[model samples]
Target: MTKNCIYSIPESFLALLTVFISSCLFAQQNNSDPKIQNQFWKNVQFGGGIGLGFGSGFTDISLAPSAIYNFNEYLALGAGVQYKYLKQRDFYASHLYGGSAIGLFNPIPEIQLSAELEQLRVNVNLEGSNTNSQDYWNTGLFIGAGYRSGSATIGGRYNVLTDKNNIYGSAFMPFIRVYF
Candidate 1:
């Protein structure tokens, strides 16, 4: 009976090893099928930010819409549009509009690195007597890193150009992103 027990133990372990190996091989084969490859536009994601605020005599509104196309598990390219309006009491009002192109790289599943180039046009109007207005364009380059969990991402970026008049308003910008 001892001899029989020793043989059965090895037989059971060998069977389990065989099952594991075959399952792994099947998964590898399935992953390599062309039909299993991601289709273009199939994994596109769309989401961005909206900002709204109201104070004693101030108002701020912003809308930014973005879209991303996943080329594979590790790379994506995207674009976005931004618009903002701000008014303070009876002082001045400003409008900012822009567009951007972005690229993302993921070396690991949960970590992302991104780069973007944007061109923005700013219009400022004085609320007082003369009703004067001025417009200008600002270009920015930003690089960033983020951590992604499921469909949400939180990140920070630094503008390399860092123009004082850039609509983004700061050298460092924090962003929250959701993918749908």
Candidate 2:
């Protein structure tokens, strides 16, 4: 509330900022990674295009793009985002949110596993009048098993969990997944 107080506050604020800036500059100048510059791309991958899945409230295919990481020949992991068509006996093609998680084979063999979760909200107009709409959220889970070779992966997953908005059923979504 006074001129002296305002002046005192800025002095300490600037001093703290100066120390933080100097510390970051010092840290950057002293770091070293032998392969950081040349081998950076080996740790990343990409997957894309049409995909398929089947489960509760979902029995059709979809399109997806994914990214992956390779830790070693026996261990790998990945994540992906997808735009999916949820197949309900009563509904047509709709928008859904989906993601993928993968676990690679161990012991140097041709086998792998994965888990995926997909969710979406659908709105319906009562009396089909297009005035006010009713919204419902549907989610499904897929736990898969399969094989991997370098950049491609194929697997099948069962429904580990499903939150239904209407009539509920139980099934496994046997799906083929590709990792990049």
Candidate 3:
């Protein structure tokens, strides 16, 4: 059973990699048309968030990268990938990786509303005489509102499905995003 669980990680990673590569290729193909290429590049944005923490016995790190395309002034859609690692001194470690789809609405120039749906695979390893490990999947939905400036956004979100085993840690999460 453990071996089967371990195998799933590579499978999942491969699947995500395929999607990522396909999207990039598709975008490149579409760019062959000058008008479409200009419009596409103009509407596309890149941004994400990072988290870091360290203490005497523990460390946590998170990175999320995303791309967004503005369909119009009021609507935008995007995809993102996330990676996180956490460790506690001589005790245990965990790795999380996932992807998400995001939607955003801007009713005004400075306020934005957003929603995200994500699927994450988490693996935990226990360091001890027994040396046990486990893997599982977690799905989450988040809704949030934020203040948006020219190229920066700050927001807080609430996970409606607050599973105790979630790698995100809490029902509420804060984020800072900068687009280029």
Best by TM-score: 3
Candidate 2 vs. true structure, TM-score:
0.59
lDDT of each: 0.88, 0.63, 0.90
Off by over 4 Å in 1: 1-38, 129-132
Tell me the tens digit of each residue's lDDT in model 3 across 22-101: 99999988768688658888999999888899999999999999999999988999999999999998998989899999
Candidate 1 per-residue lDDT over residues 1-180, each given as its tens digit: 899999999999999999999999999987795644656557799988899999999999999999999888799899999999999888889898999999988898898889999888989888884647878898999999999887777899999998566666588998887778
Predict model 1's lDDT versus the native.
0.88
Off by over 4 Å in 3: 1-33, 129-132
Best by lDDT: 3
Q: TM-score of each candidate?
A: 0.74, 0.59, 0.77
Candidate 2 residue 129 Cα shift, in angstroms, is 5.4
TM-score of 1: 0.74
Give the per-residue Cα lDDT of candidate 2 at 46: 77
Deviating ranges (above 4 Å) for candidate 2: 1-27, 30-34, 51-61, 85-93, 98-101, 105-107, 122-134, 163-170
